[model samples]
Target: MDKEKLAYFKEKLLKMRSELIDKLQKKYAEAIDIGKGDGLDSADEAYKIYNRNLMLGRVETDALKLRLVEDALKRIENGTYGICISCEEEIEEKRLEYVPFARYCTECKTELEKKGLIRM
Candidate 1:
């Protein structure tokens, strides 16, 4: 990709990374502030456990996305941002536009999914 396009994608990835970090921080704060409702009824205890689990899952997902964004930024620095890590081919522009942190082209990604090497 050209320098201009690379810069654009870098900006997008950085923005996404910032958002994910902010979300993770907020979730972490909430998790720390969560109290153990020792005196709560059974239904309330169940609800609290469910919400905590849901928040934790979201935090994990956001952390994964943040890592991907950081990896994409590193690839940009190495001049391999738009290339598929699995196939060593240039990823489609449309795919890059949609997922600026994609590590593989569609074909390679599909193959990995089929082989249970990666998940969506």
Candidate 2:
């Protein structure tokens, strides 16, 4: 990709990383607060447990996305952004624009999914 496009993607990825970090901090704070003693009946305790599990799942998802964004930034630094890691092909501009963290081109990604090597 051209320098201009690379810069654009870098900026976008940085912004995303920042936003995810902020979200993670907030989520962590919420989790801590939720862990504090909440005197309640069994029903209320069950509900709180469910909510805590849901929050934890969301935090895990966000953390995974943050790692992917960091990896994408590293790829950009190494001048490999916008290239599919699976097939060593240039990923489509549209795909990069939409995902920015994609490690595979559409075809390679599809093949991996079909073979159960990757999930959506």
Candidate 3:
């Protein structure tokens, strides 16, 4: 990829990273005091537990995405952005546009998925 394109993806990734961090912080704050001693009845307590779990799950997903974005940024620093990590091939621009943090090209991603290597 050209320097201009790389810069574009870097900018997008940075924005995404910032957004994810903000979301994670908000979710963490919400989850921290959830279900505290509030004299809630059993139904309310169940709802609180459900919401906390949902928030925690979303936090985990966001954290994973943040790590991927950071990794893509590192790849940009190393002059390896837009290349598939598994095959060392240039990933298509369209794929990158859809997923700026993609670490593999479509073929390799499918293969890894079939092998149970890629996380859901």
TM-score per model over all chains: 0.92, 0.94, 0.94
Candidate 3 per-residue C-alpha lDDT over 75-106 given as tens digits, one digit per residue, 9 for 90 to 100: 99999999998999999999999999999999
Model 3 clash pairs? none
TM-score of 2: 0.94
Ranking by TM-score: 2, 3, 1
| Cα distance off (Å), candidate 3, residue 12 | 0.6
Q: Any idea what lDDT model 3 has?
A: 0.93
Tens-digit per-residue lDDT, 5-60, candidate 2: 99999999999999999999999788767766568888887877778778888899
Q: Tell me the whole-model lDDT of each prediction, alpha carbons only.
A: 0.89, 0.90, 0.93
Instruction: Name the runs in model 2 displaced over 4 angstroms.
Output: none
What lDDT, from 0 to 1, does candidate 1 have?
0.89
Pairs in clash, predicted candidate 2: none
**Cα lDDT of model 2 overall?**
0.90
- Backbone Cα, N, C clashes tallied per candidate: 0, 0, 0
